[model samples]
Structures are given as C-alpha cells and as structure tokens.
Target: MIELNDVHKHFGPKTVLHGVNLTIPKGESMVVIGGSGTGKSVLLKCILGLMTPDAGTILLDGQDVARAERDAFLARFGMLFQGAALFDSLPVWQNVAFRLLRGSLARPKLEAREIAIEKLRRVGLKPDVADLYPAELSGGMQKRVGLARAIAAEPEIIFFDEPTTGLDPIMAGVINELIREIVVEMGATAMTITHDMSSVRAIADKVAMLHDGIIQWTGPVAEMDASPDPYVDQFIHGRAEGPIEAVR
Candidate 1:
C-alpha cells in the first residue's frame, strides 16, 4: 500500500532520512522503532507531503505521492497524533467529526454526528461523553476521542504517532489493543512510530528499525526479538551498550 525508495531529506547542513526504503503491504500494520532525532516524524511528514524531500520518491498505492492531488491523497489518510491534540474549544462530538464537517469529506450535520458517535463507541467511549468538552474528560477518554476522530472519515490509511504516550501503562495497553483491533477490522494500512515496546508488540505485524537515517532492520514482528542485528537488539532490549549511543 505504501513504498519508499531511496527517500532522502535534510535541513541545511544536517541530514535525516538518508535512503529510507520499505514497503507496507495492503491492510497490514507496520511499526517503526527508533530513538529520538532519527527523523521518524520527518519521514512521515515527507510521505504526507507536509515537508518536501531533498531527494527520492514516496508512493502510495503505486502512485507517486508528490504527483497526486493533495486533497484526494490526504483524504485517504487519518492520523492519531502523539498527544490526543484535541481542540479545546470544540465539544467532543464536534472534535471527532471535524473532518466530516469540512471540505471534501463533508456530510450532513446529523449524519456526521452519528458517524462521530459510532466511531467514539468503536474506540470504547459512551455517547454521553460526546457532548462534553475535552477538559471535562480524563486522559484516556481524550485519547479515545483522538482515535475516534482518526477513523471518523473511514480513511484507507492510518498513521499513529506515539499512540501510547502520556498514558498510564494500563491505559496505554488499552489504546494499543484498540489500535490493533481497529486497524485489522478496517483493513487499513497502518504506520506507527513509537518508542514503546509494549505498543510495538501489541500493534505491529512487521517491525522496522530506523537508525542513522535509514532502515537498519525490518522483518515480521515474530522475527524482531530473535534478530541478530546490533541496532535492532539495542533498540528492542533498551540497551545502553550497543550500536545506538545513549543521548545522555
């Protein structure tokens, strides 16, 4: 569903994502694991066309992303940001229906609301919570709302950025399970970037280790633990004494 071939991007003298290459099959979950500053987010932005790449091509469903119509290309995607990143001013239902109530994907107000409520329920939230504001909810509820918004448009591709960040371990686990279930049920191609191993184990069918601006190791999740690559070993095991240098 997605492919990156020799993708390269850099800012001035600093380079990130040097020759990133990988392929994600249709309707599968692929998680990218890497340390901070490894340009995981940058890679995502490049694919989304938010940032122009210095070199290389990104293809979505066999067409170059750069050449695709922006609205149509982005319409195929949904994103769950690192934090819930909810709009404080909007009520929960409105937040979830934000896409459906706007350009390209717009629907009748009542239909959009119904879809929002259903998506909220899919992420394990009750309808009563829909009328409330983000501040009225707990962290878990807010995250659920984010997930609801992500799938509101029924996008063909979903990108999760640190989906478990800022949650208690139990809540994180809940989110991971929800993500895994939803992606499989919807048959959407999933790409996630996260440092959480629990999230990786829960959501990933394939694991890609990105380091030094390229993919160091990539294979089925079943092979990740037993892989012999030093970079993969250091990352999945959280070692301070391997190929990856500790930030501190």
Candidate 2:
C-alpha cells in the first residue's frame, strides 16, 4: 500500500537517507529497526510530508504523496507519537476525540466522546478514565490513551513511533499485544519504527534493518534471526561488536 523508491534526504551537507527504498503491503505490519541517529525519523517525516525529500518518490496506493492534497492525504493515516503527546489541559476523552472534534472528521461533542470511549475500551481502558487528565494517569494508561486516539479516526494506515519506549517489560508486552491485535482487527496498514526487539517480534510481520541511511536487510520476521546480514545480526542480537560501532 505504500512504496518508497530511491528516496534521499539530506541536512545541509550531511545525507541521512541514501537512496532508501521500501515497500509495505496492504493490511500488514512492517517494522523498521535502527539505532539512534540513523534517520528513521527523517524517513518517516519525509513520507508524512513533514519534511520533503531531496530526491526520489513516495507513493501511497500508487499516488504520489508529494503531489497529493495535504488534508486528504493525511486523513487516511493515524499516528501515535513517541511521547503520547496528549494535551496537558484537556481531559482524556477530549484528547482521544481531538481529531473527531475538528476539521474534516468533526462530529457532535457527545458523539465524539462516545466514539472515544469505545476506542479507549478497544485499547483496554475503562470509560471512567475518560474524565481524568493525562497527568493523573500512569505511563501505561497514557500509552493506551494515545493508542485509543490513534485509532479513533479509523484511518486506513497507522504509524507507531517507539511504541514500547518507556514502560516496564510487562506493560510493554501488553502494548505490543494490543498493537498487534488492533492492526489485525482493523486491517490497517502499519509501519512502526522502534529499537525495541520485543516490539519487533510481537508487532511485525516483516522487519527491515536501517543502517548507514539505507535499508541494510529486510525479510519476514520469522527469518530475521537466521538472516546472514551482519547489521541485522548485530541489531537483533544486541551485539556490541560487528558492523555497528557502539558509541561511547
């Protein structure tokens, strides 16, 4: 459903993505794994139109993303930010319903709240939690809230950024399961960028290793462990040696 062909992006004199190419099929999850400063965020931002690539093309369902209408293009996608990114002052329900309450998806406040509550339930949250502020919730609760918001609009595509970054292992596992289930239940095309190996196993059908500003290796998740690529090996096994140089 999504394709990137020889995509390149640079900052000043530094090139981040060097002719990166990737494909994500419809209704499947693709996880891109990379260490910090490897330009995963840059690749994502370029695809989302947050930043324009210096060259090459990105297509969504065969339509050029760069030439597509911004609002309409964005309407087909949902995002869960790394930080949860809730409105500090709004109640949880309002936060989840933010997109539904404005712009093209606007609905009556009551109806939006009802949909938000339902989405929260899908993410294993109770309706009673809706009235609380983000500050009142635990990290796990906050992540669930963010997940609820991401699916509230029922977008055909979803992007998850470091979905298990800060939570404890158990909670991270919960989040991963929720993500895997939701993507399957909703049949949404998912692209996730994370360094967490647990998340890759739980949420991905296919995995790609990004290094040196390109896709170094990619294959079905089941084959990731046995892949002979040194970069993929170093990353999945958490090896300090190999092709990847650990920063001191």
Candidate 3:
C-alpha cells in the first residue's frame, strides 16, 4: 500500500535519510525501530509530504503522493503524534472529531460528537470522559484520547509516532495492545516509529531497523531476534558494545 524508492532527505549540511527503500503491503503493520536522531521521524514526514525529499519517490496505493491533491491525500491518513498533541482549548470529543468537524471530511457537529464517543469507547474510554479537557486526564488517558481521535475518521492508513513513550510500563503495554487491536480490527495499513522494543513486539507484523539514515534490516518481527546485522542486534538487545556507537 506504501512504497518508498531510494528516498533521500538532507537538511543543510546534514543528511537524515540516505536512500531509504521500504514497501508496506496493504493492512500490514510495519514498525520502524531506530535510535534517536536516526531519521525515523524524517522518513515519516517524507512519506506524509510534510517535508519533501530531495530525491526519490513515495507512492501511496500506486500513486505518487507528491502529485496528489493535498487535502484529499491527507484525508486517507491518521496520525497519533509523539505526545498525543491534543488541542488544549478543545474538549475531548471535539479533539477526537477535529477532522470530522472541518474541511471536505466534515460532518454535522452532532453526528461528529456521536462518532467521537464511539471511537473513544473503542479505545476503552467512557463517554463521560469526552466532555473533559486534556489537562483533566491522566497521561495514559490522554494517549487513549489521542488514539480515539486518530481512528475517529476511519482512515485507511495510520501512523503512530513513539506510541509507548513517556508512559509507565503497564500503561505502555495497554496502549500497545490497544494499537494492535485497533489496527487489526480496522484492517488499516499502519506505520509506526518507536524506540520501544515492547511496542515493536506488540504492534509490528514486520520490523525495520534504521541506522545511519538507512535501513539496516527489514523482516518479520519473529526474525528480528535472529538477524545477523550488528546494528539490529545492538538495538534490539540494548547492547552498548555492538557496532552502534553510543554517544558519550
């Protein structure tokens, strides 16, 4: 459903992605694992057209995303940002229905609210919580609300950024399971970038390891442990003595 061919991106004197090539099949969950500053987020932004690549092509469902209509192209995607990134001024339901209440995807406010509530329920949130603000919720609750908002529009593709970051192990596990369940239930193509190995295990069908701005390994999650690549080995095991150099 998504393909990147020899993708390259550079910022000034720094190169972030160097010929990234990856293909994600329809309804597959592909999780990208990499150390910090390894261009995982940049790769995502390139795919989403938030930052245009200096070289190569990104195709979504066989069409070049660069040439597609911006609004229409974006309508097919949903993203759960690293920190949930909720709007402080909006209530939970409105935040969840933000896309539904505006633009070409817009629906009546009442209808949007109903859909928001349903989505919240899908993410294990109660309907009463929809009336609360982001500040009123716990960190885990905020993540669930963010997730509810992500799927509220029923997008064909979902991107999750650092889905398990900044949560307790138990809460992270819950979020991970929720993400896996929602993606499978919706049968949506998913791409996630996280350093959390637990999340990769929970949510990935296939795993790709990025290092030095290139994919060091790509395979089924089951094979990740046995992979021969030193970078992959170092990353998955959190070993400091492998080929990956730790910054002092």
Candidate 4:
C-alpha cells in the first residue's frame, strides 16, 4: 500500500499540498481528479520523488520512499508521461524498451527489442510499427506506444499523467479501455491524474479529488456521483456555479 501522512509542499511562498493524507491499496487503480492548479500533478510528483515535500511522510509498503535507494527504488515503478514523452530520436521499439536496455533491468539489445514488440502487440500496435519513430505515428498510436513502454518492464507500480489529454473522444475512450485492461492484467498498483470524467469512469477503481491543497474527497468510482461533497460534485459534473470559483 501507498500512504501519505500529512504531506505538505510549497513553492517559494505559495503552498500546493497542505497536510494532505491518502492511501492507495496494492493492485488498485487510484485516479486523482481536480481542476487546474489544484496540485493533482504535484501529488503524483511527490509520490514519485520527482518533487520533495516540505514535510510529512510518503510510504510505499511501509518503507519511506524518500530514503530508499534511487535506482533500485525506481526500478519497480513505471511512468507514462502526459505527452507520451517518447524520445524523438529513437524508434518506437527503442522507446518502449528504454527501461529494459539499462540499469538494474538491463537486457541484450535483441532481447529488448523482442520484449518491446510483444508489449506493443499487447497495446494493439503491430511489430512493424516498432521500427518507426514517434513523429511518424498519430496521437492515438503514440499513446499506445506510451502505454506499451509503461508496462514493458512489468513494474509493480505505474503512474499515468493525463492519459487522455489530447485525443478525440473516441480515441480517448480507446486509450482509457486499454489502460484499464493493462492495469488489471498486470495486477499493478496504478495512480493516474486526469480531469476527464470519461477516463475516470473507465479507469478508476477508486477516485480521489484534490482541491485547496488537500484531498477533498475520495471513494470508489461507484460512489462518486452520489458523493455529498460539493467540490467533487462540482468538479465531476463540470459545474461552474458551485464551490469552485470560475474565472470571468
């Protein structure tokens, strides 16, 4: 399980996370939802150790992540960045096999390429696409490549940032379903940050709402619509007239 105990973060004079607390059980898909600037990404970054919290503890299976060995600790986690974040210079196979090509999980070049092709197939891409570059694929195909890369190493945990950000609704739905399938098949602990309600309904086993520097509400996906919290209702329903302020 992952636990955050009164975690806090600040940027210069501005506070982002204020005494935040949440827990995600092993093998569950937890999706964080919130408006822009609500610290949704910050929370993910804090957990990933990409950003240091100013206070409190972040524990993964009871061990403090901040104090763990960097390479060894990160080897168990995979990340699918918001923009896919594939290396433009590398082929799709190389991008998917990036983790398998180095560090603790290193494998031979040919073996890595084979593993990459397998993962690509798992995400609905063909082996032929593996030799192409990221710039050569459509946005949806790029997302599939990103998803393939994320699961290539078979990590125990995965983080997805805005998994459906730039796609059309149909493509977004496809990506969402793909993510749900991969997470279940791997039985991996998954944490995603996204504002898309369709994505939430498709991917989240549990949903968390981050607002005002804290987790305002959290529960199973089934409970989200009936949730009494105004923040959650306003956000999920995309209402501009509730507790959340709308800019003029």
Candidate 5:
C-alpha cells in the first residue's frame, strides 16, 4: 500500500501540496486527475522522492519512504515518464536494460539483455526492434519501449505520468490497455497522473481528483460519472464556467 499523510510542500513562496492525504490500496490502479499547475506532478515527485515534502509521512508498504535509503526506496518502483524519456543515444534494448547494467541491482550484461528483450516482447515489441534507437521509432513505438523499461526491473509498484499525453485516440487506448495489462500481470500497485479522461477510464480502478492542492474527491471509476462534486463535474465535462477558473 502507498499512503501519504498530511503532506505539505513549498517552493519559496509557493505552496504546492497542502496537507494532501491519500491511501492507495495494494494492487490497485489509482488515477489522480487535475488541471495543469495544480500540484499533481508535485505530489508524484514527492512520492518518488524526486522532491521532499516539508511536512508529512509517505509510507510504502508500511515503511516510511521519506526517510528510507533513497536508492533502495526508488528501486521498489518503476516509472514511465510523461514523454517516454528514452535516451536517443542508446539502442532500445540498452535503454530497457539501463538499471540492470549500472545500478546496485545490476545483472550480467548477457542476462540483462535477455531480460530486456523479454520485457520488450511483453510490451508487444519485436526482438529486432531492440537493436533500433529511440530516434528511429515512432511515438507509439517509443511509448512501447518506455513500457518495456518500466517492467524490466519487475518492480513492486509502478508510476505512470501522463502515459497517453501525445498519442492519438486509438494509440492512447492501446497504451492504456498495455498499462492495465502490465499492472495486472505484475500484480504491481499502480498510481498514474493524467489529465486524459480516456486514460482514467482505461487505467483506473479508483479515481482521485486533485484540486487546490488537495484531493477533492475519490471513489471507484464507476461512481465518477455521477459524482456530485462540481469540480469533478467541471473537469470531466470540459467546462469553463464551473468552479475552476481559466488562468490568464
């Protein structure tokens, strides 16, 4: 399980997260939705230890992540970044095997390459594609490669940031389906941050709406449509006349 209790983070004069509290049950996919600059990304960063909260406790499987060994804590999770974040200089196989090659959890080169190829196959990529670099692939292929890397380490938990950000509707659906499949296959606890309603519908078991630096509402995906919360209603309907104001 992942739990954040009374978390607070500030950047100089700006406070991003304010007493944000949430608990994600084990093996569940929780999707957090919010508008841009509403601290959704900051919350993920705090959970990942890329940024620390000034106050609060973040626990992963009952262990305090804020104080845990950074490397050890991070090793328990895999992340699929907003942009695939693949290294243009490296071949797809090498990118997927990155952790297995240079970190404390390093494996032998041959074994790592084998594992990378296996993960690539898991994400619906052919073995021959592994020899290609990120620049040689299309956006959808890059996403597949990112998915391959995410599962390469076989992490206990996975974090996906805007998994379908730039994809067309069909491609977005494919990525969402792939994410759902991988999470279930690995039995990994998943938390995804996104603005795409299609992604939320495809990937979420539970949906949490982040607004004004706090979780405004949370419930099963089935209950989201009928939710009485105006903020959620506004977001899902894509309206400009609701409580959420358009920034200048």
Candidate 6:
C-alpha cells in the first residue's frame, strides 16, 4: 500500500536518507529498527509530509505522495508519537477527538466525546479516565490514550514512533500487544520505528533494519533471528561487537 523508491532527504550539510526503498503491503505491519540518529524518524516525517525530501519519490497506494496535497495526504494517516505528545491542557477525551472536533469531520461535542470514550474503552482504558488531563495519568495511561487517539479517526495507515520508549518493560509489552491487536482488528497498514526488540517481535509482521541512512536488511520476523547479515544479527541479539558500531 506504500512504496518508497530512491527516497533521499538532506538537512543542510547532513544527508539523512540515501536512496531508501521499501514497500509495505496492504494491512501489513512493518517495524523499522535502527540505532540512534539513523534517520528512522526522519524517514517517517518525510512520508508523513512533515519533511520534504531533497530528491526521489514516495508513493502511497501508487499515488506519488512526496508532493501531494499536504492536508489530503495527512488525513489518511494516524500517528502515535514518542512520549504520547498529548496536550496537557486538554482533557483526555478532547485530545483523542481533536481531529474529529474540527472542520468537515467535526461532530457534535457530545457525539465526539462519546466516540472518544468508546475508543478509549477499546484500548483498555476506562470511561472515567477520559476526563483526566494528560499530566494526571501515568505513563502507561498516556500511551494508551495516544493509541486511542491514533485509531480514533480509523485511519487506513498508522505510524508508531518509539511506542515503547520511556515505559517500563511490562508496560511496553502491554502496549505492544495492544498495538498488535488493534492493527489486526482494524486491518490497518502499520509502520513502526522502535529500538526495542520485544516491540519488534510483538508488533512486526516484517522487520527492516536501517543503518547508515539505508535499509541494510529486511525479512519476515521469523527470519530476523537467524539472519546471516552481521548488522541484523548484531541488532537483534544486542551484540557489543559486529558490523553495527556502539554509540558514544
């Protein structure tokens, strides 16, 4: 459903992505794994139209999307950013229904809150939590709220940026399982960028490793562990010595 061909992006003197190419099939979950500063998030921003590439193209469902109408293109996507990215001032329900509360897709305030409550329930959050501000919730609750928000619009494609970051291992596992269940339930195409191997195993149908601004290896999750590529092996196994260098 999504394709990137020779996609390149540069920020002044730094080149982030170089001729990156990959394809995500419809309703499939693809997890992108990489070290810090490897452009995983940048690649996502480029696809989301928050950043324009210096060269090449990105296609969504065969339509050239690199330069598509920004609003139209973004409307089809939902994103759960690192650290939840919620507005502290808004109530949880309002945050979840932010998009639906404005413009053409806007609904009655009562209806929007009802839908938000329903979505929160789907993510295993209670109705009572909907009225709380983001700062009032625990990290896990905030992440669950983020998930509810991402799926509130029932978007065809969803991007998860470091969903497990900053959470305890158990909480991260819970989020991973929830993400997997939601993706399956909604049949949404998912692209997740995370460094957590457990997240990769729980949420990925396929896995791609990015290094030095390009994909170094990609294959089914089952093959990731046994892959012969030194880079993939190093990443999956958390090895201290391999083709992947340790970050300073």
lDDT of 1 by residue, 1-248 (tens): 89999999999899998999989998999999999889998988888898999888899989999999999999999999887899999999999999999998898999999999999999999999999999999988888999999999989999999998889999999999999999999999999999999999999999999999999999999999999999999888998998898967
What are the Cα lDDT values of the candidates? 0.94, 0.95, 0.95, 0.95, 0.93, 0.93
Instruction: Work out the TM-score per prediction.
Output: 0.97, 0.98, 0.98, 0.98, 0.96, 0.97
What's the C-alpha lDDT at position 88 in model 2? 96
lDDT of 5 by residue, 1-248 (tens): 99999999889999888889999999999999999988988999999988888999999889999778989888889999988999999999999999999989898999999999999998888999989999999999899899899889999999999999889999999999999999998999999999999999999999999988889999999999999999999999998888999766
For each of the candidates, give the backbone clash count: 0, 0, 0, 0, 0, 0
| Candidate 6 residue-wise lDDT at 28 | 98
RMSD of each: 1.0, 0.9, 0.8, 0.8, 1.2, 1.0
Evaluate residue 176 in candidate 3 and report its C-alpha lDDT on the 0 to 100 scale.
98
Instruction: In angstroms, give how far residue 148 of model 5 lies from its true place.
Output: 0.8
Question: What CA RMSD would candidate 1 show?
Answer: 1.0
Q: Which pairs in model 5 have colliding backbones?
A: none
- Candidate 1 clash total? 0
lDDT score for residue 130 of model 4 = 95
The candidate, 4 or 6, that scores higher on TM-score is 4
**lDDT per residue as tens, model 4, 1-248:** 89999999999999999989999999999999999888988999999999999999999999999999889888889899899999999999999999999988998999999999999999999899999999999999999999999999999999999999999999999999999999999999999999999999999999999998999999999999999999999999888899999887
Locate the minimum summed-lDDT window of 10 residues in model 5: 239-248
Residue 15 in candidate 1, Cα distance off native in Å: 0.9
Residue 199 lDDT, candidate 5, scale 0-100: 97
Which ranges of candidate 3 are over 4 A from the true structure? none
